[model samples]
Target: MNIKEASSRLGISARAIRFYEEKGLIQPAKQSSNGYRTYTENDIWRLQTIAALREIGMSLQDITHALAEIDQGNQQGLEEYLELQQAVMYAQWVELKRMMDTTQRMMDLNRQDGSLDVSHLHELAGSARRLREARQNWHDRWNYDQQAAIHDQRVQAGKTKEDKPFSLYHNYDEALEQTVQWISPVSGEAGLDIGTGTGNLAGRMLNQSAVMTGMDQSREMLRTCRRKYPQMHVKLGNFLALPFADHSFDFVVSSFAFHHLGPEQQQLALEEIQRVLKASGTSRICLTDLMFTDSAHRDAYSRYAATTGDAEQQRALRERHFPLLGELCNWLGYLGYETKHIRHNELLHTVLAVPRP
Candidate 1:
């Protein structure tokens, strides 16, 4: 096969194949009579292997070393090389997850009250440094320490009646009420609240005599929750890996928190929520975040932020990850959830879904 044929058969770009050949990771089998470089079956296999390694996050240098070992028939050396690369990739994943969380927190702070505070910027920098120093492994995408501190501050502010969290949304209370109605928890029915900041929604469910177990990644937030609702069960855990047995809850819900996850992590978290939910159980997610269907919508938001004269809002609008409502519904459906309704406004969205029968 010529380069074009091999590229098509291997599902890689021709330029990528040429670059790999340049790096000595692959080579053409021979030069045809017409002076065209041709690849044999073995060459295609080698290119496929190189592509596979790259997909698994291997660097070019590491892949070259592994390929060299394979050529030398050093099976054990290749295994050791791959194992080392796996460890390095895992460390990088942890750092990237921490950085993602820090960036999300910064965006959230920027969105608050339509202005950025200098002290908040300093706090964000400190949080980034702490995340780097801690180097801890986490199942979810959020940095718990920073999130917990922010939640604690919000809780304190709520107590003082100064700045209520989620107050910016005109329909915040209505959305919460709608989610509760959709879940329709009966007395003694077990419910799980993922990312239950300060146990607000869980407390509301508790009012209906439902058994509420709230989970959050932040210990400080859980502390505040425990103090607020002495009888409610609050645990420190991540949405990606719910620390619960399968089929544990009759219903699951989250409020204004799911958007903290990236698109991939959001799907994983939904899967985890499904795993914990009992058959026929419902999930209501009240999301007070921005969602843009395309770049044009994003540009319009930018203009709106500038017109409003909120520098912080403009930054938040630029940095936040706003998934499309249609895409979110598709993810839920693909995960075997029967999506019931997706209600939205300029600044908020609510998704109601149930486990497929």
Candidate 2:
């Protein structure tokens, strides 16, 4: 069978079959008379298997290894490959089930509370938009390599800790003050500090809490946190999926990490935080993230954006460079938390989110 027939039989594009050929995964018999490629039923079977594996989330490298094992007369290897596939499918099924359950619960809550406070409705919608902006701005634009480069450049420049692009250094004193203001400060209960970038707050605030656990997604940050606060507990993990049990924490606080997530994931993290907090638990937000109302910052960041990409990408880049206060208030409201913006001289905004009565 020629390329056309092979593609027709496999229900894939001829270009795709050619791509597989380039990958050395498939080779067709060469016809000398017209220099045409020809395939057989066996080739068709191989293509079908490749397609099936790809559909089931197997990487091309994995499929290539499986094919190599088959060519080596290792038939039993197929069983192992199938077992790996089953494991992947099972994990995906579990994730899908969780998503479905969450969506169903959201729907039920929506139906149960047709009288949603206008403030709450606006808060949720605005928060979703802010979350979308954050993902597009910060986390999506920043790859692992970019993060490393930024870290190295800051080090090479001998930049002061205060000169760091995003730092919680200045927020430590204010954070401690806020903790003291908590209506009923729990001084001896376990707490988890999400996004504990430098552990500055964790170290200072640990004295106020019995057991303080600091978790950050960045290993480099965690390394710094560990060295700075040897007695504190620090782990690397995403805020959206904390590795703790429900009601495991007496208080959960994040120092400037919430804006990195997409809106939905932000809410998911908030919900998870609420779940992990004991009844009447408290959360304090000292968002070091900034948004530029200053024309100089706007101009400087604008030039930075233009050098990178299109206007859309530029604005996204700038958004990551700053945080918005009103948007933060909306996010707190959506999560059913009361918010009060603390007056501060620094660009960072402080808000507190407490469970609704």
Q: What Cα-based lDDT does every candidate model obtain? A: 0.71, 0.63
**Candidate 1 residues 132-226, lDDT tens each?**
54333334444555666566454444333233222234455666787787877889989888888788789989999999998776656776787
Total colliding residue pairs, candidate 2: 4
The collision pairs in model 2 are: 131-263, 290-322, 290-323, 291-323
Give the TM-score of each candidate.
Answer: 0.53, 0.50
RMSD of each: 19.4, 11.4
Clashing pairs in 1: none
In terms of TM-score, the best-performing candidate is 1
lDDT of 2: 0.63
Worst 10 residues of 2 by lDDT: 158-167
TM-score, predicted candidate 2 vs. hidden true structure: 0.50
